[model samples]
Target: MSSTPINKPSALQADKASATTSANLPEHISLSKWEDSGFEWAGQVASRSFERLNALLTTEHLQSDLEIKANLYRRNNVLHLSFTLTGEVWLTCQRCLQPIAIDLTDDYDIALLDNESQVRLVGEEQDCLLLDEIITEPAPERLLPLKKLVEDEILLKTPMAPKHDDCEMSVEQFGEIPEEEENENPFAALASLKGKL
Candidate 1:
C-alpha cells in the first residue's frame, strides 16, 4: 500500500475518455472515472484502469447479484487499466458461525493484460508496457478477461457465510459445549459436625 498511493478515481486515464470520445463511449459511468489505471484482455481493445475496492480482498461474501466496473487506457505501447467491483454476498459469522448475509462493495487495481497475437492481459499490480518509440511489431492490443477476473475475484473474496464474534448457543441449552465442573463438599452436613468438634 506504500508504493501504491491511494489515488483518487481522477488519476485514471478513463476520465479522459469521458471528455474526448463522447460519441464512441457508451452509457458512461459517472462515479470517479479513473484515467491513470489500465486493463487488458484477449481479442478486446485496450483497457482503462479499474478502480480498486475499498475493502480487503479476503474471503468475504459475494452478493447473489454481482456487478463490477472497469476502465482501460493505452500507455507505453501497452494497454493499462483500473476498475471497481460492487454487489451483495452471503457471509457466516466468525464467532457465532451463523449466516450473516450482507452486500459488499469492493475495488481492484488492474495493471496488466495478456496480449498474445490478439490482446494483452492485466493483473492487480502496477503493470506497465512499452507503447511508444517501439521498433518491434505493433504491440498486441491489451484486453481484460473481465468475466474470469470477476468470477475469480468473487469466488476468492466471497465467503461461504458471514460470522459473528460470539457463539449463538443459548444459555438454557449449552449445545455441544460442556459446562465447567462445580466445586462443592461431598458431605457438607457431616463436615459441619466435624467443624463444631
Candidate 2:
C-alpha cells in the first residue's frame, strides 16, 4: 500500500482564494448568456480603479471601495439589468473648496435595447441603455465590460456640486465685506441735495 501525503492550504492562501473567487466579476460579460443563466454578481471594487470617476474627485488616492451588485434577467422578452451601488467618495465642497465626503446609494433598472427603435417598446419611463452606445470593441454582439457599466453608474450618481449638509461659507473665504459709511455713499448726498433744493 502506498501512502499519499495531504497538503492542506494555509489560512492566508484559503482567504486569498476565496476573495478572488467571490469579489472578481468577469471583465467582459455576454448579455445573452448572463440573462439566460440568470446571473447575479456581487463584488467590491476600489474607487480609484475608475479613472474618469477619480478625475472628478478631490484626490486620486481614495481608501473607500464601491460595493456593486448586478443582476441580469429577461422580462417581457426584453433584457433588463438591475444594479445597486453603495460607496463613499470625496469631492471638493463647492461652497468652501474643502474636501467633503459623500455617501452614494443608488439603484438602476435599465432596459437593454438592441437599437434605438426598441426604446419605444421599453416605454418612456423605463431607463433604456442602447447596446450600440456601449460597445467599444469589435467583440461579439451584446458583450460589454462590466467595469464600464459600474463606472458609468457611479458617475451618474455623483453630484455635480457636492457640499457638506451644514457647510457655511465663512468670511475667511472671501474676506469680510466692507461696511458702507453714510458719508461714503454718493446716493445719500444726491438725496440730501434734492431735499435742500
Candidate 3:
C-alpha cells in the first residue's frame, strides 16, 4: 500500500498536482492496512468532482477547490477516522433569486466497527460507523471508498436553505402583497340588504 508523507515538501507538491487533476486517494482503500500504519493524506479536490453535490449548486463554476485532510488509525482495538474539509460552493439564495457563495468547513471523527453489534461495545458517547455501510465489495477483501465518505460529509454539512448572511429581503423577488382598497367592501351589500329588511 502506498502512503503519502504528511510533512514532506515533495509529497505536498505531488498532492497539489494530483488534487487538481484527480483525487490522490485510491477509489477503494484497505481499512486494515491504513488502520495498522496510521495512514493520512491531505490535499485539495476539484469541487466539480463531486457529481451529487453539483446537482444542488446553482452554478457550475466554483470559486475554490475543496480542501481535505484525513487520517485513519486504531485506538484500543477500534478503528477511528478523523477528517477535515473546507471549501466554497455556489448555492441559490432562498431569499433572493441569485447565486450566492457559501463557505463550508467541517472537522469530524468516527469509530469504525465491523458489525452493528459492536456499536454498543464502543460506548454511546463516540460516533460509530459500520464497515458494511462503507464497504462496496463482498467478503474477505473489504475496501472502503474515501471519496464517497468525503462527499457524504460535505452533503451533511450543507445547509437545507442556503442564504447569504447579509441578504436583503426584496418585495420584488417575493411579490408584494396587494393592499385592500378601503372603498371596496364585500359586506357593504349585506348591510344594505339588512337595512331594507
Q: By TM-score, who's the top model here?
A: 3
Give per-candidate clash totals.
68, 0, 0
lDDT of 3 at 149: 77
lDDT of 1 at 48: 19
lDDT of 2 by residue, 1-197 (tens): 21111222355235434544576555666764544444556778777778898887786335587787776666656667777888888888888788888777788888877787777667788988877777777865567677777777788888898887898875454777799776776688898899799
TM-score of 3: 0.69
All candidates in order of TM-score, best leading: 3, 2, 1
Q: Give the lDDT of residue 27 in candidate 3.
A: 55
The TM-score values for the models, in the order shown, are 0.37, 0.68, 0.69
RMSD of each: 14.0, 10.7, 6.5
lDDT of 3 at 112: 84
Model 3 per-residue lDDT tens digits across residues 28-83: 55665455555566777777678788888886345578788877766656777778
Off by over 4 Å in 2: 1-20, 60-62, 170-197
Question: Candidate 2: lDDT over CA atoms?
Answer: 0.70
